[model samples]
Target chain A: MKTKFKKTLYSLSFFLLSICLFTVPTFASGLNWNGHFQTETRVNLDNSALTWQETNLTLQPEVVTNNTRFYGELCYRRSGLLSQNNSLLASTNSNPIELNEIYLDLYAYPWRRMDLRIGKQLIPWGTGYLLNPTSNLNPEDLRDVFDFGRYLGSNALKATTYLGEVTITGVFIPVFTPAALPHQQFQALFAPEMPSLPFTVNEQKIESILPAENLQESAAWGVKLEKHLLGCDFSVSYVDGRYSLPVPKITLTPVGEKVDLLCELIHPRRKIIGFDLAGAYGGLGFWSELAYFFPEEVKVTSDLTAIIGQHMEIVTLKDTPYAKYLIGMDYSADHLYFNGQYLHGFPQEQGKDKLGDYFLGRLEFTLNDGKIKIPFNACLEVRDFNKFQESFAYLFSPEVCFYPEMNTEITLSLRLIDGKSGTNLGKMKDWDEIGLKIKYSF
Target chain B: MMRKTCCILLLIICLTFPLCPVLKSQELTAKEILEKVNSLLNAPQDQKLTLKLVLIDKNGQEETRELIMMQKGKDLRMGKFLSPASQRGIGFLSLPNDVFYVYMPAFKKTQRIATRQKSGKFAGTDFSYQDLGTQQYDEKWSSRLVRAENEQYVLELQAAKGNDTGYSQLILWVSTENFYPLKIEFYDQHNKLCKVLTNHKIQKIAGYLVAQEMEMVDVIKNHKTKMFLEEVEFDTGLSDESFTERYLSR
Candidate 1:
């Protein structure tokens, strides 16, 4: 039976590969590739005492010729900080890092309407919306900078199929993490656990949750479905196995009058739902999601009381829900493109009564025989305490990008964030950054 | 004898100068070639075309399908591909960058695809996002005659002063005999050749001559796809409502 199963798997793979080789020819009529390199430095104009300098060099090479495709990227990053006497500071340190991404794509179609794609590539779930399936790796705000050279996703095997107006994608993610030396007597000291219960394996204690020794070696799976109907496009995603991190515990609830009550800690799972609509009349797009985390050992108790009492009564305890919603509209004008978006995120665990909100606006205009394209992007945030705490947390940002030629662009960005009366927010300072970038594309 | 030789040379120079002016006038400039092709394309009072397509690449493998096309002066109807689950049945594409509409037959509603998305693929075929538009070359492009080769004039065109198009420049080769387009190439803002369109199988239909088979290939990719027109009807009696979402759902 085992031999037969192995044979069947091999046969299936052979058949699929043959189909791809026949459908998508492996050669292009002309060879086309593009490479872009950018070096960026960030300085805090407000405080010379606190300064950060980083240089990033990235190279992306892609070849699309004949009917076959090939693409890969390589990147190196180095960052340093000079901290003088400050109220709160970590350590003055400089670090340089290098990373590598290598992958190839092959496409083929044997079935009448089905196309197969095999590669280690980023699989975006929604159409450049908030519920991005590939956001886990290359997380960037589309309104600000374009970081196409960043890693979009971990290495994975993926397949995409089209049925009528619906597109379905399935991916198998291969997780890989670095190994560390064995823990010696002193090395184990930082492990931190009760002497009797060295290396506690309790899934119940919300605050002290760690992954299994083989967590990074396991495989995760994700699937996405998209369809365009009427004037709207809708997509839903379900992913399992290590997609999201645990949500911090705000309170603990004890089990029913037992001598040893249950300590509850919960984290949210990752799930996404999104929709978009664009017609001749106008364009409306929206996306919303609910993520919940559940700690293994935590039991839901009556009138739960952990860490902070009664405050978490608002939270169901076992599964904490973190939610976000976005709505946008686009108006089609002859010489101008105008659009606006609203985003709101529900706090996961930081506070009981606060949620974050964002307002975004954009405009693009053309002139001088299509030689000059002027673009404007603006954003405003309200009640910004969703994932973390802040004293006067409000965010406002605006940017303008100009295209002098098809391959050339220059951008200027202005940003401001007002925290509460007192808070220690990391490298993020309330200041404006004016930088310039030039690109040569083929 | 010397005086006679000088007079004869002078006479020869005068005749050649006059002929140069006449010859320049006889030859069409780059702009004139573009205008000729545009005139022929826009001359048809009304036309409705339904054709079958067989897309083939360099490997000689092919996918067969059908499409219905219509054009009435400024209005037009491009092909609506109904195959493969991904593109299935989409709404017909209507023109003008402002009023571009796509009717989804499944939803029984016409949705408008964004203008920015017009450069994407159509029906998962080899055609580009911009190929679905009912763009009038004369209205959208300013033409200049580059040169003539093998009885066909090459025309270089830029987007007209008031028009907004994705391409920075386009080079088209038109046959002098019927003004039929033989081949065309599109360049992006970076002057990179992005798309190539070729017309083959020229035939005559109801007193109108046109290419019955055509292909649109992505020059930069290994994928070069073609669209073959089996039966083309030039002046079919198609109502304006045929282009409407109401009729599309039916």
Candidate 2:
């Protein structure tokens, strides 16, 4: 089985290379190669253990012709330096070789003011900072929880048309891709939860079921109209697609007062209408994003509820509308840069009543001609402001970076958190960590 | 004798007609001289070039990066980084009325930059955003002829009233043969010499004068930035579309 898996990997790599070669007309002059190498180690303060350690390299190759641009990104990672678990599954989890993105851009093809882009690529929308409420086209990449706002590129066909100063963009994604859960260590924290039962004495197991790749069930599409008006950049967009995050579909089996529950997570359909505006005023930059979500109803039923005939079905999610929004501003001068933002909801979080509030701020100081820098970043999450003492959590990270050599950066950082046990971040109270990162680019 | 005087006067009048433009230039006020220099600076309808930038630290260690720059009209400009793997695909668009947007490759989005941010260094280089922008010098600075030395005209420039600039004053030396600036010394708010800019290897390309090499030195920080024009083209007929967000992302 291992040999077969390796063979499949090699074949896929060969196929990518074939496509790259065939698309470039002049290999010697058009092909461009670049990327970076990085190694990072983070230690948990609670247990004094290596929470995360990995070294990775990315190779980016792009070909630019007169009318087209083809680009690709591939990464090789080696992780778990101290762990003894070396199973094939664990190796696959580390994902030694991964293709992150590959796309082609056709400029003014088939029309004078239209551009077409096809293949797997990143579609960035919205004007918010790290917390974007309107830019959900690409699924979340939760593999690295510390890296907020990371997303996986999706296979899509996008067409952009220019009409005067207004731009109209349409996109179609034929296949379905689900959001990636966090690493094994944080899986339990990010997993879907089972609904509260009348009798709590029970057994539980989580299972994930993916939707089939069919047009009616798995496909997604979107359109956006953008223009510059009132001294600001504005856009209105609509996307009809399945939720990247899954909803619970539980099956209950009761034995006397206790119940055994099979918690199954499945993707559901949803539609979003969004608008964003960004502009500058009096030397300050400000932006806002607002989005409303309408999710499909999801009802869960048990296999055997003969004893409780009337209580056999439970609604996991109601067909209701919810809102998400973010506002941000930034200012920079001389040696200091500062940014602040407020977000009403986070990705993977659904429903209007369940949303939390987040406040974020970042300040950086550059000294010695950008050779040495200091940055302080913090986030405050409040589940309920009425019970701020017990329902609020805050995380602060202060870091220093030094560029002692050319094309190199070394950073040392500390993550500190404190909160009650009821909120999301409060549950990870013992996860305070100190990290070191070294990166070199060529 | 009357006939001879008439002939001499006619000969002198004929000579004076051709030198009228030259005499006017010689006696030109500082503002007129600045306008003439600015007209030459903004002569190209559009420009395309590859810029090689080298940053040097106090220890003499150097790092290099490359970018492709395009400019249409006077204030519309765009630049895309082509090297330094960490910064590749990063681009910026500058519009006519101090509007600027920067495309961050990691985030895959274009962000608007605040006007005050222009005072910071660009890409860790010694050149600030104000230095990179194409500005109408006569409108922003009051230029006065200081002296003349070695076929060069020295001028002193002071920031105009109500103009918020990083530098307080600049001393510029221009070649008399051509209106190109040969050297510039920048003074800080306290009237201290903080930086110096030098242009070298002046050449005529596509019937336009260009400085093939330029360097800016920050004395206070002991840093330097050297720029080389590896490839240059003039009058490319670049359209307004090139300065849009679509082109910047590509």
Candidate 3:
């Protein structure tokens, strides 16, 4: 894996060098380079051990001509896997440098109001600040579990056309990529809690099944139509793709008094219909996002005693439609800013009958001419409204940021989470942590 | 002869009643003055300007920002930051009816700002969103002539009913020649002066009056922001499309 990564990096570097050499002759408005360097450290409150620490630098280079432009983002990382049993699996390609995004844009092509872009790019197709249910084209980036709203880019072709005040966007992606799971500790959160059985559990294993790249099903496409009216921005979209997260199919084998469970994780095919609106009235800014998902049926098979006696199957999921949405509002006055959102059903949740509700709020104060900022953020997840006290999970994080000079910032933050085990957030109750980050942009 | 005298007296009384108010006052009404100022401010169909903003702190330290501003009609305006790498690519669009939207380059997203947020500082500058917007004073403020001079008219403007603004009152010195404001004093709710704005180097550019240099001083904070016009163009025929979110994000 490391050798392959090095080869890819070398190829990319040579390609970028060639582009520079080619453009140096006809360069009028040449390439501009800028990005940032960041280092972050986090410590667990429960064990006082370093949970995460890394240093990375990103470089963004863009070349612009009159009608065409090229943009690229390259990141150099200095640290790899920390300590964990499955650290090798959790750490990414572990390359010294990775290409985050590269794309070429053609403006006013074919028509006066049309733009086309191709290559690895990010399509941020949602209006909500929280969980954007309308953003469905790209896979989720769970490298940092706390960075809740990040998405990975996709190599695709996109075209945008403006018809007066309306904009139409179409995208086609030929390949599918699964979500980047978090580190080993956080990756455990994706597993389902095992039910009590007569046999004592001994060992467990997970096997992930990804669709073959050559298959026709390993593709995604989406379209969006956006318009501004009534002093608001509105959009409707549709995506035909598969969910990036894997669902588990458990197979339990009993041996004497102990049992082993073989967990098979498979990506499910799904389609999404989404809509969103963003507008402000007077002193209040409001936004709403809605998405309905249609999924294919999936069954989990369990070996009761296939070698000794019998086989059984569980209908884990059936083809059903579920909805996810959020309504949010924000207001800023003087140096204070407040945002609140109520979300229904997280992206990982799939069942029509098993959706949860969450409330997210953030308050920030900027002082000393924006040299310092303090923000308090909170989230509450409720599995059952009737038993809110027993089936509720909550998290609180407060951060202080100081800007000592231009384009430089230092931030200190504390996060705490707690709840009963019934809620999803409760599974990570021991994740209380304190973190510090220093970032500088050029 | 007595009947002719009565008729003459009746006609004189009727004619003098209408002239009494005009004779007593030599100043234009607040509405009439505001209309004149609006007309002068919005004389051009569209305008494009390149400006450099210098911020001076109390400690004598200075920072600078560069931007391009576009305006169509009275209230449609868009501004994009061009320099100060941190603020570069940030843009805001203001349309009629107090609609506003801001684009953040890092997020690659556009957000609509609430009307009340107009009072907030823009991009860490001393100027608020309201100060940067191409505001129609006649639509937002109610005014009364405070003092008159040989070459200027002093007007006190109050926030109209149902209008929420950061300032309680503003004293404006309007030029008699072009009806353009030469200076303004901003007062807080306590009626204390907090900020002062002065325009200098007024020049006629392409048949329109333009201020070559402008400054806003926050007296309470002892800070100053000065803006210099690098390039100014009037009546450039900017379309409504220029004020949309597409261009703002671009």
Candidate 4:
């Protein structure tokens, strides 16, 4: 089955590439092509045993006719561990080539006020820079937490209409795709859980059941209305879809002096209502986004007779509703630019904490007509302030970029992390490292 | 005695009447001359043109770019890069009230340019966003004619209060025949000459007098950018719809 899927993907890629090269020039005068090639190498500061290298090449081509427009991108990436001595990280995929996006846009469709877009495309729907809680039309790509590049596009149909200063947009997605997760190798080495008891457990296994694409009821849809008024841009939207994160339905049983645990990953249905606003006053630019999510519940059962009880207890794991919001501001003066954001996540149910509230800031200074630049960035979690008396996790990244030519740049950076273990960013403290990258665009 | 007094008064009047024309010409103020210059420069309500820019470094290295631009009325303008393979599909749209937007082909995204970013260089050229569109002298600056000599008028313009600009003052040399600007010098906030722009060639096209070639030199950096108008058409029937965001990606 995997081989057949791979063959189909390869054939589709070739077909799209051929159309981009051959059909564009003959049909349109606005045909254009541009892309970039980059390479990066990273080394761990604490241990030389953990090192990685990656190389990427991308191609983007676009064409416009009188009323129809076509856009597409293709990427080839190769990454691997620098040292083979680490057996836990040796199972990762080292090479992959994929089609990032391909879409067709029809302008003034049926009228001059509406537009239609179909095929694989990204639908960005929020004002937050790093994390967009209101964006639910497409699945997120969480392979790298630090990088904010383009997310993987999904097959969708979108229609937009403009009425004076207001716009309305609608989207329909027929397929169900889950958000990509971090590499299993990295997770195994860094995400170890502490045991509460001193007993040895055996036969622990996890099984995930994703919603099949053939299920007609698994489709998602969303709508948004945007307007500019009182010198501010505002938007209100709602989405009914599946949650991007999986919920575990756990089962436990005790037999023959040993315990067996089973975890079945399931994606539950969810509904989100969101709002966003952005505006500028004087020298400061401000933006805010808020979203509220309602998720379905799951069932969990545990056998307690082996330790403290004589019966099996059945517990209900209810997915609680939560609200997430981010507020940010940006300012620039002379050659310095700065941006800061405050994020908060409040759950409707008490005693349940998802990702905690945090603050993020970025500062950049440019010199020599923007040929040389230095940037500093940091993020700090503000949860558990009174009890812990300190931040849960703190990350700092400082980088320098030099542009020798118009289309080329070289960058060097260092990533540092400090926190207590078992936390979101705290667990990755050992991954602190320095990196160098060079990219050329054409 | 009455006949002798009358003859002397008549002789005095005759001598003063011969100098009246010169005094009347000197009565022209700086603002009047600027108004005439503005009228001549903005004669067309709509226009379409192809522009070629050649940038030269201090060491004499040269790079060239070509673009097509269209303007409707005084506030709506759009430009698209046509040459230099890497930047060919980039587009810029300027609207009223200092609103601007840029379309990048590689990302298939059209993003609004912040008001504070107006002072940055445009497309790797020495020109800023404020320099590309139509110039409104009365809106931002006050002018005074310093002198008129050799059939040319030299004027000095100072920035109005509360106007955010990189330059504090500008000096212009305009031709008296057609009221066209021949040379201009820009002074930074520190009162230093930072850049100089000179018109090297002029031609009449579609019943409008136009500058065919011009050069902008950075005095401090010792670099220069030369612009040439390859083609121009006045009264091109352009409308507000042509400058909307819907057409930027196209």
Candidate 4, residues A173-282, lDDT tens digits: the string is 87677665556645442222322433345677788767765536568899999887777778999998886555656666775566676767667787889999876665
Interface Cα RMSD in Å, per prediction = 12.8, 1.6, 1.4, 3.1
Between prediction 1 and prediction 3, which has the larger TM-score? 3
Per residue, candidate 4 scores C-alpha lDDT tens digits across B102-142 of 77765555655556665556776777666776666666788
Clashing pairs in 4: none
Evaluated on chain B only, what is the TM-score of candidate 4? 0.87
Give the range of the ten consecutive residues with the poorest summed lDDT in model 2 chain B: B17-26
Overall lDDT per candidate, in order of appearance: 0.49, 0.82, 0.81, 0.74
Q: Residues A1-442, candidate 1: write the lDDT tens digits.
A: 5346436644544454344344334444432233344443334556533333334455544455423354444445443343464322222112232223334444434543343444434444333233322233222211112221123335567666666567776777654221111112112211212212112222344353333334353455667676655545555665554323233333333443322323323332333333333333323323333332222222233343432243223233233434444556665443466777665542121222234565667777754323355666555454544534553344444555554433344555555545553321111334444444443332
Clashes of each: 39, 0, 0, 0
Q: For candidate 4, report its TM-score.
A: 0.85
Error of 1 at A181 (Å): 24
| Model 1: docking quality category | incorrect
Clashing pairs in 3: none
State the weakest 10-residue window (summed lDDT) of model 3 chain A.
Answer: A84-93
* A155: Cα error in model 4, Å: 1.5
Judging by lDDT against the true structure, name the best candidate: 2
Decreasing lDDT order of the candidates: 2, 3, 4, 1
Predicted model with the maximum TM-score? 2
lDDT of 1 by residue, B180-205 (tens): 78998988767788789899988776
Model 3 misses residue A124 by how many Å? 1.3
What are the per-candidate TM-scores when only chain A is compared?
0.60, 0.92, 0.89, 0.88
TM-score, predicted candidate 2 vs. hidden true structure? 0.90
